[model samples]
Target: MASETDAPVDGVLIGEEATPIDLTEQAEVADASFAQVSQVQTVINHIHGDIGGASFGISGSRTKSRRTSGPVSGHEMAEARTRYERHESYEAAAQQLGRCNMVALIGTAGTGRRTAALNLLHDFVGGRREVVVELSPAYTLEKLATREYRKAHGYLLCDWPKDDVDGSIADFHLREIRRRVRDAGAYLVITATATSLPAGDQILWQPPPARDVLLAYQVAPEIAAEAAAHITPEHAMADVVALARDLAAGAPLDQALGRLESAGRRDVVAWFDAPRSRGELFEMAAMAFTAGLPEASFESLLARLESIAGIGMEKADAVSADDPMPSRRLLRVAEGSLFSLSPGRRLEFKVASHRTHVMRELYQRHGMRLWEPVIEWLHECAALRDNPSAQAEVARGVAILASVSDYSYVDSTFLTPWARGNGVMRSQATAAMAVSWLCLDETTRSEVLRTVSSWTRASAARPKFTATLAWSGELGIRFPLEAVRMLWLQIRNSEKPVRHAEIALARLFAALTEATGNALPMLDWVARQISNDKRIGRAIDPLIRAILSVLSARADGVGIPTVTAHLRTRPDSAVPLAKLWSAVLVKRPHRRDALAALYDAVCAFDERDDDDRDHVRALFAALVEALPAKERPLLAHDLRRYAISRNTDENRLEILLSLLRVFLSPAVLSLDTIGKHP
Candidate 1:
């Protein structure tokens, strides 16, 4: 045994005793090629396909097994692909490694050097030499590095220090054979790429070993011609050179090369036969190669071939929902089939929660489609949320279903009845469902306007109060003249003050009048209710004051005179003082001609009442003595209209009319003298 520090020179005639590192390091050693960790990762990626059944278990003991697949013959699908080698400039430095001493690949790593070394090993060290020993960085301790060389010799053959591993391979978790190889002084390797290795026992990649090992896998000329002639479909030729290169990788020989050539394959020659991006680039080539393999070939030749970066085969399930609406439709339209690769992933809407992670793994490792199968599931899951029973995402679900701002159509046609309708779900389910529809999107607002027109035409004879509120507040309409018209009518027709009337008033006045306009009905209702419910009459005063304020604002020499003549016939039933103060007193601030008439009427009524036993009889006498014969009919009509409008008796009307006739027929008497007549 000898240390690299004290090694004897060899090329030591072909079969002479090679230096044994095991004695120096007190560890068992074996033989293996030297390569870097990145190269190892590249090869491992290809071999890792269809591997779910091979789960890692708590291992005290285990048996080894190997699987193989056939290869496409060089003649069958060949191409005269130019063989290329990684430049020594890009190579990571190599060194003797392990306590037992094996050829160790060492370097302050550049780029493709490690992987270039791994690729060479794939061609030369075709058998068990394929296995790689991945070592964890924590095993820097000498005691840990050589711990498992003897146990691992049968299964593993190379050692790659995650970060400068030496000494005990065991401490670094080296595969047994890798440990032995390092201890045996013949295997050297590097491990610095992947955070973890799937299987350590496989040839990953390396620089060409012996010339025999570096055999260029070229196709026959005709095959290359044929393959080259067979151009990829024009539409599939996005990044055309990439496709041509893939075609070359798949064709058996130059026989196909002519075909590829005839197909104008050289048009995309830039992507042919070179290693650029290890993960995706390699996977695409592998997939294409695997697809083109001949049925008759032995799979053993292709077994443990390097993996396309992070790819594999798995069982795809029937579509699962991501949302509630049109889930099936979305699935129907996808171009590719769902492929299950990783577990606990697309298990749900389980989309790539992190784009950096998914995108990096995919692009960095070869366009990994880990979320594709589940991506559609995401689309479908999005649809199902609309089905209130499936999930509780009402806002999202409704957003999906709505073609407009209002869901009134859904309510009228489907949802509202469904809320009260018999079904597996109700209450919250119904609420969610209704809410789903209730929520309006940009388009739904237009739909609401259209529906309102239809509603209006249908309700031409009826009122449209409900529809109005539905449009305004609920739908976020700021200016709706149509809505306002409906509100104004509802207030006038209502039996008493309704709660929505205030909401209607506030919204309408704010919109149309800038908070200045109000209907007279509110003032009338408040006054009547207050006077009737005397206990809270004082509470009504402020509102009355506000009404007065608005009325005065409306009275500035306007056309058609907003002042009502309707109250003139039935003044007792009207708020005369309120109206007068609001209109004339507040606005004019000066004497009014109309005030003299009111004062004269008041004086006449007082003089006639005198406490006479026949109060009505004396008032009639006073009224008749004061009037002229020509006005009798007009006075009678006024009294009649007043009583009827107030819903009072005809008897009161007759008494006033009769008193007016006392001074009729040119027999009028003085007002003071007429009091004795009763």
Candidate 2:
């Protein structure tokens, strides 16, 4: 394996800016059969977080009070004050509130009705902070009508229920609410769907163009304009805001928009649910699964689908009767040139978002009647050794299916069968990739983690190995601490530690250190593990090897080792680094590797004109202090012998010997001897 420094940092992981490990390369190194699963690597590279850039959910410094019932928190209000974009109806609504002391803002869902209401109340109260109290959505017209209000304060009621027993919205109720607000010298804004209320008191609201909302969030104008091109009247303000936030965070426009459209629209469901020929439905399924593959691959998969679904005869009969051209039939469901002269022509849906929707509806609503055949087809595709790309695309489709369908059902039907036993490496790779995908969505992430964690304890090596591969890829990148902890569990529980588990631990640490440019957290974790056990037990050999691997790994075209660079960036990490190094030196098997890595770091620091030398000296001092007095002389002798073998200049060798001497002085030795006696 290439050193960490020589490893090229690939694309970013979803919701995180981390270097993704090339699992295919790593897998091949362990088992040559894994070379055929290269498509797994490609799938990992293309996976992005869902819209909103939150793998878990949108997180910020804003307080939790934003979601609670009370006066809106000052922090939340300040945020809204900057990002709120007023609709055309906002001014008219504002004027009504100013004159009547209350106004009802009505609009279709996702039109920013609630936002307009909040803004109106904020302006009506003259922008006084925390004066805007958000009333519960459960408040009925009767309660609101008789409710007393605070003078000079603003009240906002969002999405007030229409089915309240107080009866449908009436003119008398509006008049009473208005009277109450005016008498109290307060303002109230009620946001609701279009209702049979008096027009004089209600303003039908329409949100501004999606671009304006994006701009309000400080999104780049070009990106916002491009995103706005795809926005339709049906796209909700909330989804658009999420899109803007994602675009601002440097997410690709197409991927973000695809997730937005897939989540926001149900057109795909309607299309699938509508009456359609069995042949056509099968064609759609084939297209959904093999959309990006070449035309020949599509035809092969489609034929397999038709055959499995018992629609081949039906498809032939329909073609004989209607004689519709293949392109025309394909045009009905998908959008690609079937007759393109190019040999590499690919077939895909007109709307890329529909592919996921198609698979989701087919697997969920259609159930096993469709899923059994689809699973069989996916497995066949996974077994295609001649077309690794097709196999990869199959894995991608399976991941999407797993994400959309009932997870347990997918697990039973597909993941379990492919992941356990002597299943082909390609199939196991697909299962592992699917688990990684499940980890990307907030709804499924925890469940996926729990399931994979359980798999680590399975008696079968393949399942455990699959779980290890899942963590070594995107799962580890997104949740490094959890990934590390769970991997340790797998390692400690094994009767004999799996080599793959050891390699995965190393990759996880290397990728994390490369991405963060700081190894302190990982180094600190190693220190804690060592200190808690108070012995360099064989159980922690994997952890020790991982630390050494990181220390020796180098980036491409960079001379400094990963650890040296980390020390230069954060000199304080030397303390923890030394502690881990001390453990490595005493581990016997890793002693030589640890010393060699330390010598390289010392040499790199010696060449620099900065304070990095002090870090090296501190590291050496801590390393010596952490060792037993009986081991210090042995460590010194090892360093001298290792330096002589390397044939380095005397200055570098003298630097190491001198630090060892200072920390192992007669006074320190006597104190260590006394402590051991005590």
Candidate 3:
């Protein structure tokens, strides 16, 4: 089999940015069959705290030890598929394909109405793979697609072979197909309008989103300059500056706008093109009137010009907030108001940009309290069926409430029926996670679980529920540990468990920090969780050792001088970053003296994605701090071989230089005699 080389991933993939709290591609692979999987060293991105740029690699083959939730009912779906000879041998192939990480069915889709029914059956019975049931037996292509949840992947496939429907169906499916591979890890291959059944797993082909495009805009930069020639203006730079002063000093911006509105332009297009100081507006208007163009069209021309690209607007009439922050509710911009300290610099107007402008405005004016009432009003408006912005209002409301950790009060008026059905539940998985930790009666807790379960999609219930259960164990909730153990047993094979587990751990850590003001204790506690694993040390031993190393070196020392900053973040047993870091300093061949080898390891780990950089830095910090002062010079020298630091040189050269310094030191080594140790 051919190896999967470095393939481009879709979306702004994890680890692309700095300060990621997730997994990154840190190391390389040299193992056969999997060598390529790890060879392409990439930055590790943390997702919901699961670190895995490399671990993100999908390992094929079904997990052998875990049981399927519903049944091995792929057999039943296969049987239904064979009934019409439309998809024969459903059982023979479905049964033979045991423990496949994914399973998919391919057949020539026609206008068969039963196609959807068949696909649903395949999913309900044996959903270890992607299944599509749309042969489009009836109705138009668009109609069928819109009616049913026609996702590209996720145990569902839809096909249309009629008329090509002007190719819109293909385009629509293409988006979902690409989404399947990127978002959910389902590989997709659309046959366009063709309906030939294919052999197993033949659709490992790449999706279009995986291909890179030149991010530079196709429109040339010079186009704006070319277009800037046409707009005429009524405003002069100086006049605009004065106008901005009055408005920013608490004069209503609309008042200034009203003044412009009546200036009587005969509905013509004019643009000032220059900066919109009040003086500039006046100067430009004077120039336009002095010129041959009629002054009547000035306002109209100005409005149109302002709308066009590269044209200026006396846009900020109020001194709105300068920054754009989604969180920090009290922080907001005041539009049309001046904010600068200097008199002349005092200016009206502020930046007008926010995806959720309404909420942002409400926040600026009254912060969260008024925001609550505004959302209530929007909710009332939505109830009256008039507020089109209700959804956005509700979403912002949710964000505001969430930022404050008022999880119990999640706003529902903005939640779509579908959101209530699925999205909220996915989001709630974390918000309501405290329930697992909070002291509560088992009966009451069970009731809460049942209520939460009712809100989620049927498929999502167990995964979410199991995740919560694992969380409860991590929190040291006064429940039987067996419940936690059982939940793990149920989901050990599922793809989402580890992710949920990691999330649960993060929350558990947060709660501990809030209560104890420490992170080191979590290590000893982790031992309890891992020790309970039936497989004994096999499951969490590596994590135990790894977490221990990070914790052992943490600042629990006396006098508080050694106190580690950012106690909220600690190594999780799952990530075992210490082990990964130690590999750099460990044994290497020939060019592999311990320090030199460690330098190389640091280099390898350091060459990671942007998101992983901080984590790598943290690892570097921990490793250095862990060493005794006596060994610091030796280790620093070893680090010179590979560790690259932009501040001085790359990690290697820096480490190598430090090592040279140590060798040159009279107290450290006698460099004149190569064979002699210091």
Q: Tell me, by lDDT, which candidate is best.
A: 2
Give one digit per residue, the lDDT tens place, for model 1 in 467-577: 333322322122233344444444444433433333433332222221112223333543343345432233333333333332322122232112232222222223433
Model 2: colliding residue pairs: 4-553, 5-553, 5-554, 5-555, 5-556, 6-554, 6-555
Model 1 has an lDDT value of 0.30
Q: In model 3, what is the error at residue 412, expressed in angstroms?
A: 8.4
| lDDT of residue 179 for candidate 2 | 85
Q: Point out where model 2 deviates above 4 Å.
A: 1-238, 242-284, 290-352, 364-369, 382-392, 424-426, 515-522, 534-572, 597-618, 629-633, 647-678
Between prediction 1 and prediction 2, the one with superior lDDT is 2
**Taking the tens digit of each residue's C-alpha lDDT, what string does model 2 give over 120-168?**
7777786666688877553556778878898998998765535334435
The global Cα lDDT (0 to 1) of model 3 is: 0.30
| Clash tally, candidates in order | 134, 7, 90
Q: Rank order by TM-score, top first?
A: 2, 3, 1
How close is every model to the real structure, measured as TM-score? 0.20, 0.57, 0.23
lDDT of 3 by residue, 1-678 (tens): 111122122123356643311111211110110111111111111111342111111111011101111112444346435323222233433332233323333332121222323443444333444343222122233443344333333333333233244455545753443444444433222222233223353232111110011011122234323322321232221123223344435455445443331132221111222234533333232222111122332233334333332233455564368845353111211232211112332211221111112222233333443334333433332222222122222222333332222222432323222122221122222223223322121112222333333332223332333334233322222222322333333334433223333323333333333323434434444445443445432343333333223332212111111112222144232123333333323312221333332333234433334423343344444444333445545555545433443333555454446444543343343223222322
C-alpha positional error of residue 407 in candidate 2 after TM-score superposition, expressed in Å: 2.5
Instruction: Judge candidate 1 at residue 253 and give its lDDT.
Output: 42
Model 2: how far is 623 from its true place, Å?
Answer: 2.7
**With candidate 2 superimposed using the best TM-score fit, by how many Å does residue 4's alpha carbon deviate from the native?**
37
